[model samples]
Target chain A: MLKSRIIPCLDVNEGRVVKGVKFQNLRDAGDPVELSFHYQDQGADELVLLDVTATRQERIAMLETIERVRQRLSIPLTVGGGIGSIEDAGRLLNAGADKVSINSAAVRNPDLIAAMSARFGAQCTVVAIDAKKQGEIFQVLTRSGTTAEAIDAVAWAARAESLGAGEILLTSFDRDGTRSGYDLPMLSAVTDACSLPVIASGGADSVAHMVEAFQHGAHAVLAASIFHDANMTVGEVKQQLTDAGIQVRNEW
Target chain B: MIQIINTGVANIRSLQAAFDRLGCTWNLTVSPEDIATASHVVLPGVGAFAAAAEAIDQLGLRTAIIDRINHRESATLCICLGMQLLCESSEESQSAKGLGIIPMAITRFGDGVKIPQLGWNEVRPLDNGPYDAGEAYFANSYRLETAPDGWGAAETDYGGTFISSIWRGRTLACQFHPELSGTWGESVLTQWIEGITC
Candidate 1:
């Protein structure tokens, strides 16, 4: 049986783990390696080290962090943030990242998804979609959800899959840090839109939210706040999911 | 010491980390001598079939690996694409030749299921196989549908039943990643290191 993956995302800036309440005012959490150990100890299937502020030097810091953290990691690790080109993806992969996720760059030039997928194999090319629910539709946002785009979230996901993205990281900007729960309708919409596996992200406060995301058709649920705040371990979440009759990997 | 055959396509850092955590001594090698002479060899791979097959040949590891396997003195563990490389051939790359250890065809997952099936899938051992496999992480588009002759296998269900791991004598090849699968996965590496020959 294929299980729904539980991923804990670490918002990284300048190589340090930072958790921002709604993408504003970054606060240090801990070293990425330490936090990674924390999550994996609770049986996290994978880790996403998303570089929040992806400047030139910060990108290098991200690489360094990946290098150090990877030595300690046993599971898969995904590196994202300001990955503007194939070279950037290449650098991260070379630095020992198992996969690379593209956001703003993929939106600006959708072809990059095809190129990276072709170059690195579709297995490692992830397209992250930051979206906010607008009236009657979900609108895609960019640059850490500051700029709203005319692109439809569901439509972009379908296009991204067609353009060769292997997976979609659909984050809800409207619900992020709100503890409101995953945007279920938005999640199901994107899942229905694309054939690729969709990872539900943002605004999860409890195990029920994760269960809701899975029931809504997420192949995986990526939550940050709940894990970071010590509200639940990845083990606890999976235990609850299993109790709720959702198939989650328990042998790990 | 375990010699990990690095054919340039593999992200071996995590694999290496797994070994280190196990307190196992290992080395990354493209050297044929190392492949031929190591007590055990781990062929770790990531990426396309043709590219990986080409890299093995380019690094002059072809005959070396085959000879080592034939000798049956030690063992070789193939991981993911490494396992695919052991097959007769694949639908993915028509022109490329496999090492032909498994003597089976590798085909893509059906249209109904997602391609490049990522994340974890349950793995069960069959016919007195060495490892239990136990919910391993997988990331591949192509898979072996059935077990070949003279080998015990661990199977997984997706679009249908597919062989996830195969064991013969002391040798093992897994389609799923034991390195990235945490506890049970690390135990797979440990048993391989402990040399629990079937």
Candidate 2:
């Protein structure tokens, strides 16, 4: 019985939590530790802390923020942004992160996944693929969804798993912030191609959307706008899923 | 200094980090000689039990470390898959043998609780006197069902009241990741460090 996880993602910049409407016009949400504890209390399965700022300035700040958040909760924390090397993943793991999500760096250096997974375990590594559907195929995007890459999402996900990525956090750039629902076709394509767990991200407006993502083969569903805007708390979303007969962790 | 036996498993870095955070000095040893001279041994692992157990045998430190645990009152802390190794065998890998220090076997959670029981779980001390209950971190698919003679600790719910933590003679174990368990984990580690006399 693998429960579908409900994650609340927080975009961190310069030690502060920021929430953007659609990856633009960011507004300060709160402190990293405070927001993390709040999300955990509200029944978030895990917290994703994305260092939204440019990599150069926020490296140390991001690490410190992760450490502070780690001190506050015992839940799994996934740190992304500027993690370009095994040393970066090691440093983050040392600072108390459960998993590290690699985006542009992973796509650029596919061997990093294998090397890190060899040093650390595959379960400790996750590849976050930002994808946007074009024509019939969804393509992987880099630079936090700003750059449209020509790589096929499904193929890249399979490659990632082969390279020792334990899980795939697939985000739908087209559906991001639109809240219409997740790009189920894209998620299903990736999950079918790879045996690893797939966490569906983006375009989850209602509780039903989250359920649909799981039903469509997502191991877990992630929604940032819904959770951040207070439209639907993680608890409420889990409750809705449970009522809909979808398996979700009952702890919260 | 305590020696953390690395049997080709995960969580060693985090364990080392925890020790560092506690200002405790320790060494990560995969050698038989280092384990033999070590005052304390911490076994930290994750993933499949069979693979890890095979790794322990392959590394050839199994007998040496176990000898250290049995011969002296050395502090031995096994976390997650390492804790599972204390049992006799696991259903996850029935062919894979365990260290058999506690006369227990690993069983699946079944249709009851979820597999890979991910995230945080509370430790409800088996009420066998001396132990206290606290929240602990866990991430595993199989559980250790100890025989009555060796059941050290148990968590409250999930899968027919299994042993979440066990204490048999000098050997101590917890299915949870103490390094990831926060303050309660630190307390558990402290107790292990202080109570176990090497």
Candidate 3:
């Protein structure tokens, strides 16, 4: 009974959550730890904190944020962004991140995926591919979707799985921030191309969008703005998903 | 105090946090002496099976772990890859050997289901097990297909039924990570910590 996971992705810049954050219940909407507690209280299956910090000095802040959040939050926490090496991944894991997502670094040196998987275990190594529709095919985009690597997203996902990635975080660049819905064709292409479990990201603004993502072969659904917009809680999303006939972990 | 054997890989910090939440005093150590004599020893591991098994052997904790698991005083608990180590061998690493305490083998899950089965799954108690039926989070590709003799088990289904947990005397080992499995997992830890397993 592997239930579909509902994850709330938070952007942690300089250790504080930033961008599109409008939590009604949170007094300090920027604090990563507090925001994590809010998500946990809402019965989120897991939390993904992307370290959107630009400077190296801000790295320590994200680590501190992870440690603080781990001290209280019991659900699994995944940290991504700015992970350029095995050391970066190790630091986040030591700081209490259950998994580390790599994008540009993985694209630059595909071997890094194998290295991370070897040292930490494949279960903790996630290869995130931000895909943008380029004519008939989806092109892999990296560096915050500023660059296209000329690699087909589906093929890259297969390569990542062969290189020992435990999971794939496939985000649609075209649909991100638009909230129109997930790029279903691109998501299904990646999931169908690889055997690893896929987490569908980007353009998830409604419960139906999430349901469609699951139906399109997503093992988990990751949303940021939908949850941060203060429109709904993770519990309500899970409840609706359950009502829609999707299996989810029941809250105790 | 529970002394956790440092496998040198697993997410020990988060495991420590779980114990702290339970109000239990614990410490981390790779010392065989500590594991051999501690009131309760925890073997927590994440990563490759061969690597972990080799680490235990190289650290000289193999014999101590076996001795502890056989102890009548509720001595040991193993988690995830820790559970695989109790078995004699695993398909994950054909050349490497497990601790060989349990008479069983580990193999990869069959196709038709996602490999390295991740996310939350139900753990159904067996033989009047300590905890009630509840779901627990899992992140494993290899699993024990059948229950070993002289042990109690709780199984989970994905591609097929696999033993998710096994307990004998005062010792327990789980394929699913109890530390990350939410409340049902916490209750599992509480039951084991208090030596309340049936």
Candidate structures ordered by lDDT, highest first: 3, 1, 2
The predicted structure with the larger lDDT, 1 or 3, is 3
How do the residues A1-252 of candidate 2 rate in per-residue lDDT, one tens digit apiece? 345778888888999878752322224357788778777777777788888888666788888888788766656788888788988888888787888899999988999999877666676788999998898899889988888888999999989988878788999998898979999899889888887778899898998898889888887777788877777667888888899998766656
Local accuracy of candidate 3 as per-residue lDDT tens digits, B55-105: 888888888888888774655889999999999999999999998988788
* TM-score of candidate 1 chain A against the true chain A: 0.94
- Candidate 3 residue pairs in backbone clash: none
Cα error, residue A11 of model 3, in Å, equals 0.1
In terms of TM-score, how similar is model 1 to the real structure?
Answer: 0.94
True contacts kept of 2: 0.08
Residue B147's lDDT within candidate 3 is: 96
Candidate of highest TM-score: 3
The model with the greater DockQ, 1 or 2, is 1
Query: In CAPRI terms, where does candidate 3 land?
Result: high
Instruction: Please give, as one word, the docking class of candidate 2.
Output: incorrect
Question: lDDT per residue, candidate 3, A83-103, as tens digits?
Answer: 999999999999999999999
Best by DockQ, which number?
3
Q: Single out the weakest 10-residue window by summed lDDT for candidate 3 chain B.
A: B67-76
- Per-prediction DockQ scores? 0.71, 0.19, 0.84
